[model samples]
Target: MSEGVKWTVLGDDDYLEIANNGRKPVKASLRIAGDIPYYGANNVQDYVEGFTHDGEFVLIAEDGTKSVDNYSIQYAVGKFWANNHVHVIRGKSELNTKYLFYYLQTVSFIPFLSGGGRAKLTKGKLVEIPIAFPPIETQNTIVSILDSFEELSTELSTELLNRGKQNEYYRDLLLTFPEESIEV
Candidate 1:
């Protein structure tokens, strides 16, 4: 189980598919809700109605400002949709989607775009890229640790937002106080 694991192209998953290489001419009024996480080229932008794939899977941006770094690995798991500018990497039994997602982030797999322009990542290269696989238990542990860190980071962000609001309120209150009349 540890060695010679079978590797397949991402297209093997019928439900999961790569996003269109080019951006849509018009932006769709799409949004994710419920269990579906709508992913964009850069990151998870919003919640969507439904996901194209089931179970844990990885998503990579296909095109956009963030897609320039072919090696800029931005991956996420759970039910999600690969937006027009993203690539969905589904995992088989041998590989864990979360583990693959995190691993991809650490590797320089993204291809460089030329002509001093935004890089566009394609599915062909993504599927052929080599990824390291560890034991399932080990992968789970790593994912768990990362999840804990994420929770803490989120809490800190909320605290910072609250503090900012409180500061703003006090500043406004102080500014509103009438200035003492200056002697002419």
Candidate 2:
């Protein structure tokens, strides 16, 4: 929250759903190797032969582990197919889509979630979550800062993984005994 920031509910005008009519759930068995990602509650489980939406949009997991344990939020660019278990959202120009995506990640869904064992973030509950709307310039600045941090974080993670692999290779090479030293 910031000065002049207004809180408002996320409605149809603020975000648009590009998912196919009826929001059909594609079964895993029916999925085939393809170029487009088939998104579910937590992540992309498979690739489907066809795509329903194109361009950039934010995906919020409607149910499953992500809904309860980890607020599973993701961004998809280019062509993709979304099942009934995810809510596809594209923000209006006034609102930076990435800004909204980051804001939602910070939100706690526990208060809004229902259905005990398998917690769910229903459409009604999703829409009711208040959005802290800031000026476009402020939103852009926040997005830019976050984007830089994300790039740096990703680079560090990649470097760490590469180093781990390099370490493993050297360790194995140094510890190996000569064939003559081993008895058959």
Q: Indicate which candidate wins on TM-score.
A: 2
| Candidate 2 RMSD to the correct structure | 3.1
CA deviation > 4 Å runs, candidate 2:
1-3, 12-22, 181-184
lDDT of 2 by residue, 1-184 (tens): 4567757766556443435353457777877789788888888888878887787788888888444545888888888888888887867777778888899888887888889888888888877887886888898999999999999999999999999999999999999999999998
What are the per-residue Cα lDDT tens digits for candidate 1 across 101-175? 777776564443323466665566665565566666777788899979889999999999999999999999877
Off by over 4 Å in 1: 1-40, 43-51, 65-80, 112-116, 179-184
Candidate 2 structure, TM-score to reference = 0.86
TM-score of candidate 1 versus the correct structure, residues matched by position: 0.65
